[model samples]
Target: MTDFPFLGILTLLPLVGAIVVALIPRRNGELAKTIAFVWSLAVLVLTIVMWVAFKVGGDRFQFHESYAWIPSWDARFTFAADGIALVMLMLIAVLTPVVILASWHDVESSPDGAKRSVPTYFALLLAFEFTMIGVFAAADVFLFYAFFEVMLIPMYFIIGSFGGPRRQYAAVKFFLYSLVGGLFMLASVIGLWVVGGHTFDFAKLVESVNSIDQNTARWLFLGFFVAFAVKAPFFPFHTWLPDAGGAAPAGAAALLVGVMDKVGTFGILRYCLPLFPEASRWFAPAALVLAVIGIIYAALLAVGQNDLKRLVSYTSIAHFGFIGIGIFAFTTQAGTGAVLYMVNHGLATGLLFIVVGMYVARRKSSLVSDFGGAGKLTPVLAGVLLFAGLASLALPGTAPFVSEFLVLIGTFSVHKAYAVIATAGIILAAAYALWLVQRTTQGTLNPALEEIPAMRKDITLREKVVVAPLILLLILLGFYPKPVIDVINPAVQATMQDVGKTDPGPTSVVANGGAR
Candidate 1:
């Protein structure tokens, strides 16, 4: 099983699909969509097979493959997955097909007169999937950086070519922000290669970087951290996200908020902490402050958003704050919770974004003020919207609740002040999410919606098919997180070992027994 090059095949399959999709005749638009969807489905099935075959007790980096690439720079075409990467891969697989289906008529609805091409759009989507897989699966530092940078191209085209009226502006902003971040990462990668024995492999760098002096390690750490912070879009750097996410086609926004943004926190986990442990610990306090601030600030922003799509984007920023806290807390429980939050957030928020797109599709507006008492007309859509909102706010029965709870509990043990402050975001989340539902779905019926033929109709069979699996998984994982935790635990434990940290016990206990 280990000899099968599964990770290599998984990474390249979507790129191959993109090529095939692009070759289809331009007139055969439906054929192109079908091909793209089928290809995404195929990738999904293959990923499932790999997931089933993965052993919880196996080596940390499984399905490993490495081959010579840049001999002079001592880089290789390396690919592998720890439990963390595997779940992220699964997330990519699961979301791609759903995104394709939700985006089936996305280009047709836009009246911006840009002459969007469906093949081009779908091909770009598949190409983006290729980059998503590659970035997560790459074991070599240089290889990861390559995939990271290349991902921006397809997404940039997706937004610029097929998005809203201001798509060009949003796309350029997204590109420039990411490009600057990439430059920061590039400098770090070069520094890491030189200082850590001129090799770009992750395992080797981890061992070699230990000997470097404190100042050198912290500088390298900052280079990587700044790039990831921009990607994470923490606090001040996050301005690009609402614009880009608001202007992007809903399907792309789903991918953007749901899965792609996780890359920043993922990079922090996979690269920064392991490669520079002392720096990671030294910087943890500052990172926690930023994370906690982001939580409260982004939640407030979400509460105030007029555009529904942008509102969803703001919610994600708040969620990312929780993930950051979990990671920098430096406990296995918190780290594992962060990883789980990544997967669960993808599922919950992906469904929410797609649902918002559906609403926008019917009303031809993304504004909260544009809707009222939609439940009276389209009960099912209203119901789904409410459910998605609840999930976003971390309702007890939903998958996100489990992960969010874990993150707070884990953080409280080490950083009670940060943890206590961060919990306020949950209340703000509830306010924004429910307020969104109230503004769009409840109250007096909107007379204008009746005039729009599409608005009166409920979510169709195809839409139900798109959201059902996500709904089921959210509930399923909420109750039975053990399946995911089983695989994620080992990798997190390994990370704990790499950073030389242990879970801190309670300082004292008071009950019937006296404190020792």
Candidate 2:
């Protein structure tokens, strides 16, 4: 674990790049963008290298590094990558480059006919990437909380500066909701330190705090859960997502929904369950109820959205519901599926946002009514959109299908009614997905766009380069998920053990169709 400080390098590389890009003259937008892309690409390469060096099926956290920051308080600059963190790290590394590509020109010019400085835009992006890596890598609770809250800073600027007409409103709404959530998590973090003899080390906190009274533990669990649920933006707390997504630039929206928002679910799996086992069991039923409601409500709302970006955002809310259920269901398969869902959703939804950006770039609008027979005009772009949308719906042979299936089957094994109701989300997903495709691609061309040659042009080479990998990966993981599941299962099994539960054995059926 001490062989090299790979995690530190992975995080700081982006931070340094952001600083470098920021220092470059504002007029050198192209130069700033190039440096940002190169740095992001380098980070991606290093991440791949880290993945190669990572020893799967071994220690729970590899590439471990820790340094005392405040010896008196037991807070440390700790970092590591478990299977879950590794997957998220990979998602961030992969998406950052894609986002750099997609936003290359979009951020240089605004929708209101104003030119915006590109350097600041890309700089914030890199900064956002740094915090994302830190959030996934931080092993200490204090470090995690710091990274978690710091992430909102760059995102707030990205939306407020580079986003749509209501950018300020959206950005402030996002910031306030996230800040409130962070406050709750902060309280919980302090509570852990007080209860655990003044240590912020995650393992130590878990060992010490578990012995605290049940009532105090439950309060701590609620503090963390409320924060996570808001970040996951589950059900009632999810109103901020559509506003943020609808207002932010496509690239920012992708990272927001894809990688950063996932910190919520990750925190639950990493902290809530293991550190507060009895409290988790006490709250699982209620959490499951909210999860199921989020699934149905978000999907229905997605169906009614006319704006493309808002529609996509609602789907994300729905997808998070699936992930939430998986986490709370307490089965190995379900937990594994939840982690896998995080990765797959990043790919599918990120691609969707990129595609929508392409559409908005050409058509100058995101309303469903603004596009008609787009497939006839831009077959490649339309095809990619449909592919991503299908993946979003969890169609068979797409990446989401595998994870969604595992979640459902595993949930059914434990809580049959929640699983049954959650299945309806799949139906709603298909309706919205197909509706999106039909309205944008299958209908007659809108007369307003008939004479616009740019509207007819297919996606560019750069666009293809950005989206092709995501599409291929969705298909690849859909067919073969063993590599991911192998890494995730061990950690999930350990988590279940900590929570004092195991997957129930499958029942065998007799030839006469009776269960043995």
* TM-score against native, each model: 0.98, 0.98
What lDDT score is found at residue 349 in candidate 2? 96
Q: Give the per-residue Cα lDDT of candidate 1 at 278.
A: 93
Model 2 residue pairs with clashes: none
Q: lDDT per residue, candidate 2, 217-314, as tens digits?
A: 99999999999988988878899999999999999999999988899999999999989999999999999999999999999999999999999999
> What's the lDDT for all of these models?
0.92, 0.92
User: Which pairs in model 1 have colliding backbones?
Assistant: none
Q: lDDT tens digits, residues 211-313, model 1? A: 8788988989999988888887777679899989999999999998888888898899899999999999999999998999999999998999999999999
Q: Please report how far candidate 2 places residue 426 from its true position, in Å.
A: 0.6
Candidate 2 Cα misplacement greater than 4 A, ranges: 509-516
Relative to the unseen true structure, what is the C-alpha lDDT of residue 10 in candidate 1, on a scale of 0 to 100?
Answer: 96
Q: In candidate 1, residue 261 scores what lDDT?
A: 89
